[model samples]
Target: MKQPHKLWLRSLLIAAAVSVLTIVLNTLNVFEIFENKTYDLRMANSAKYKLPCDEICLVCVDQESIDWAKENYNWSWPWPREAYARIIDFISAGNPKSLAFDILYTEPSVYGTEDDTALGDAEARSKKVIQTFFISENDYDEPLFPVEQIKENAAILGNITSKKDSDDVIRRARLNYEYNGTVYPALGLAPICLTEESIDYDSIPVLEDGTVLLRFTKSIDDYLPYSAKDIFESYEAWKNGEEGPLSPEDFEDLYVFTAYYAPGLFDICSTPISQVYPGVGIHMTNLDNYLTGTYIKKIPGYVNIIWLVVLALFAALIVALSETCFTRYAAVAIPAGLSGGLVLSIAVPVILFNFGYWILLIAPLSAFIISSLVNIIFSLGAEGKQKRFIRSAFSQCLSKDVVNQIIDDSSSFTLGGKKFEMSAIFTDIQKFSAFSELLSAGELGCFLNFYLTKMSDIIIDEKGTIDKYEGDAIVALVGAPLKMYDHAKHACAAAVKMKKAELELNKDIVNYASNPKPSWMEDELYSAFKILVANNKTIFTRIGINSGEMIAGYFGSEKKKNYTMMGNNVNLASRLEGVNKQYHTNGILISQATRNLLDDDFVVRSLDKVRVVNINTPVQLYEVLDEKSCAKEELIAYASDWEKAMSFFTSRDYQSAKIALSELLKKNPSDGVAEYYIHLLDDYFLKGTYPQEKDNEGVAFNTEDGVFKLLQK
Candidate 1:
């Protein structure tokens, strides 16, 4: 398969696996505790924006009320039933719709039968009152019911058993409880069932666990509270036909829930809004939810699974597309895209919660997170493999800097040519065939390896790319794969460094004779080495450098391509390497184009204007001797004299040129350039075959090309 198709298929498989795993875990309720925590967080934040139901109020028998009753009425811990009777009478006078107690009254008051009778008589008088009962699973065969007096006289009875999840958080409310083939409405649900005569209990939304998700719209503090002691005091005053602190308008048409609120009562538990919450608050919150029609409805399990699968696939798509992008920015963009996907996963559920729906958070979040992370790992592994391939393929011919550049932005280094200005260097050993003939093939190979290693090290150090090796020649280019504006200077610098390395290697060869030969050395090879040292003959390299516009990129057939340069400029550099033999000068030669870009750090001398084979343009050549700071004083003086001689020759002053050239040769006896010029002058005077026509530059030459043609003698 193609790479992109394989990548996409792999992404799909990863996403599918993650989704399936998350769904299975969710089905098993593995993330129940964590999912509940996230649900609570959303509830707490969304509750702040909703207004609490004003029709419901809490009549709390808190510590403050108990203290007041003790201080004023001398009431003890279990305040007399007569006190509750008075409060009931007071609230009943206001004509409330219904009143319920979150507290259970399964047993008679400890004060006395008459004491309980008093509360029973008052409850019987108020038909709107609803009494509380308890239904425990541990006692399912035998449940606890309110006393006969309270149960018989009250309007209705409800189960007051508060249910808690495994995490000890009360987020859902049980709507009903069954005991002995009879169903009892929960305390919070009883009032709604009693007030709404035509209510259908089955129509109410419930989870598969047979509970309703409570949307707590208010905190405990948000409910209006009436202290029990205050209500009792106001009841006494009103019985005398005197004005009371409490009025009937306060309870008119309201549903009042009364329960214990003191911390010492041990009726507190953890809820979404508070870690320490009153048990009464849960009933009140459930009542408020039912009354306002804002109870949370859970999204179906199948629907959530669908959402999980969709989210996983979406994340996979993003990763697959990003992996296919062959740009440097993909490195950064992939992470950002994954982060956005994760944020969307959480945001979607929270947004749905605001509209009264509870969407499971952990499953979808897990799918998105796991899928994104796995795909990222896969992409990184693939990229690492590509980088390894690039390093292995190019490390031999390209410098470390250039190889790293290609790795960083491989998009820029593709198949095809790019036209740009670059410098090309061509190097060949002087008389390598004759040198090879003197030694065996194995010996020649060893010598070539050592010499080439030294020269290639210098080129790589200057950030040049070795194009190829032909016998003893090395062709290389600069300012390709990675562009360097100072390519000409780098090329020239490598050439000078290579020449210096050559001198060092020659010294090593000469000194080899002083040391005893190794035991492994063959007799014929040892003899050839001694002969070379006795004659002071060493390996020499001729290099030519030229800088101009050329096409640089991968070239050749698809099966075997190379990163190299082409065009006339590259050819000219090769021809210049051969020109060093005809001029009888130093081994390094550069075209005028390369010389023009070189800085003052290098010292160069002009050779001639010559037309090389196969190139129509006559190019000026310069011999690169050494760096200005390292050039020998005698060689510098010889260059100065040679410059003077070239000036006279170009100006058609043949006699003066001949005299100057001879004097230069006399001072520097090894100066082959000066001797060659002197020989040319002698030929011109004897044969009388020199050109008489003057070109625009005032130089007279015999060739129609208007340039010198010096061939190998």
Candidate 2:
């Protein structure tokens, strides 16, 4: 392949990996779970406005209808069968589509039932008059009504059961049902209204699962029963024989909810609707809409996938741009993009919903998140790659010793999967996120490659393993490929040496943002931020050292492999580095196990039984206070201090531990990570809730071994 093609292939590979990873992560629900959440203001908006759509047609027995039925029928008893006759008579008079009743005649009405004789007599008479719609719940395609009534009217009874999620919020309505292996349209479903338009029932979509295959056509208002609650209740008054309350025309053309006023005969309960939705009534409305040809929801599937992918790719770009730039700009851009995506995604569907079209919103969001991840990841890789090249080039030029050291640790250079059992050190240039205040990518990369070459060289000299350099942090591991009985000692020594070197380098050339004559300065800064990728202010590392059995091999294919560790110990080491922040310490924080293995003359202080989220029990975090002594002494002292603090902290004597840590710290003023921990505990243990998830830099503890681990860069 041509160079351009190879570059394109590389970009494509990155994109494909991002796509696959997004899907995998989404499957893992990582983004959804860790994603920052925003409040749903749409619910408030929904509550404020009733869905005023002209789609679903209405014929409701509103609150007034309930009142009328109450005033006349002895406070709304189940209507005498004759009242239904009147409703049938009124509806039959008009050539409306389909008359649907949201009521169930599951049992015969009780009239004069003191004795079976009188009850039998009334039942015979009532059944005789309205037998047409005594529609039994059985397999039948045609309406089952009293013979004479059938001659006068044609209808379908509502057969919808509104269901909610586990949260009791009704968001879906069942629009089809099966009986005797044959599909039957639920009386309330819109297709039943097709009877009025004289459309064939087969024209509508039906899923094999006996459900309505949402094939909505036309606007939401085109179907009726769209009355406000106040308007639906008037029909009860018109049902009684004494006097017809509404004009016949009102009753004639209307598709009223022929449901009872009693709460037991439900049409008033709520489901998981957007707002205060009357579940049964809203269902009736939905069915009426289905009947009148005003469908809102569409068939969900692959057509939406294309848009989903596009949007996701777009999201990746937005996020990548954000990460590639300064945090402040990223702050504004990412959240705005995320929020805009969320709102536009949901709002478009809602607007379409109002317009009588239904579109799936959730899946699209899934796509956007996938896209954002892609862009951010790919962009970061681009930044890091440029930095890495600069690193490879400059270290070879800077000092032959550094270059030699890097070559010695060449097995651990790959990014995605490389492993080492050495101590992993994380250092940030402190506010390196500010470098782009006005610098281009090439300029920035040159700036970072400079210091990265030097600091990283010192680490390499100590036999450290280099992991990928993050935008501003160089994560390297020590004690791998070639282990030393005193690996922790070597790592600790190197950390101090590296820090001292960074300080020395910082003096010669101050302002790294300038050009070529100023090239060295730019390279230094670039090596740290863009190329070297330092983490934060003043070049200092948060070192987490856990040691145990770790893989010193390449992971991935021969085509593209990285020397990364993949074992329980490696993760624990990463967690420990992050834990440095909790402890408020700098350089060389080890696990309890690492301390246990070393000799006893040097002094190492106990940090705490720091809690990492993955671990239920806290691991003892220790600081290597004095690297000059035998590794044994520092480990022993650190182990002993933790032994004392753990006993105190476990008993919940947070105060005692706090003071003890303070004392330990006073004896060792160079420690920042540990002091931070003492204060963290003072602020936390005194409170009632558990502390937040561990940002122990990436530390994980092996209780069985009592060690600290730093597995990668």
TM-score of each: 0.53, 0.38
Model 1 accuracy (lDDT, Cα): 0.77
Query: Which pairs clash (backbone N, Cα, C closer than 3 Å) in model 1?
Result: none
- Where in model 1 is the C-alpha error above 4 Å? 139-141, 382-713
Output the TM-score of candidate 2: 0.38
Model 2 residue 610 CA deviation (Å) reads: 48
Worst 10 residues of 1 by lDDT: 691-700
Q: What are the clash counts of all predictions, listed in order?
A: 0, 129
Give the alpha carbon lDDT tens digit for every residue of 1-713 in model 2. Answer: 12444434444455455555545554564433112111112222232333333422444444445556667565444445555544544454443444455454433344432322332333333222111132333336444432332323333333454443332333344555555464445555543444454335464443344344222222222334423223213344445533333444553434444444332233343232322233345555455445555433454545454545555665655555445453456546665665566566556655654544444444455555444433433443465563453244335323556434434553233223234444545565543545644346776676667668887888888877786676657666666666666776666666667656766665443344222344333344444443223323345555567766665554332122355454556656766766655445655677777777666634666655655543444567667755544345554565577568657765667788777667767766665654655655766555633343232233333334433232112
* Tens digit per residue, CA lDDT, model 1, 1-713: 23999999999999999999999888898767567767777888788876778888888887778889999999887677778778788898999988887766666777778988998899989887788887765773566787788788878787877778876678888888887687888888888876887346466677887888888864877877888867877887889887778875689889898887763453666687665578777777878887788888889878999999998998888778876874455555555666577678888888888888888877787787678656655765577876764465446545788668767875443235688799999998887756765667776766767778889989999999999887789999999978889999999999999988988988877676567777875555555567677756688898999999988886532123467777779878987887887777778999999988987767788877976654657889899988878888877777777788889877767889888888877898887877867776786633556523221111245455547743211
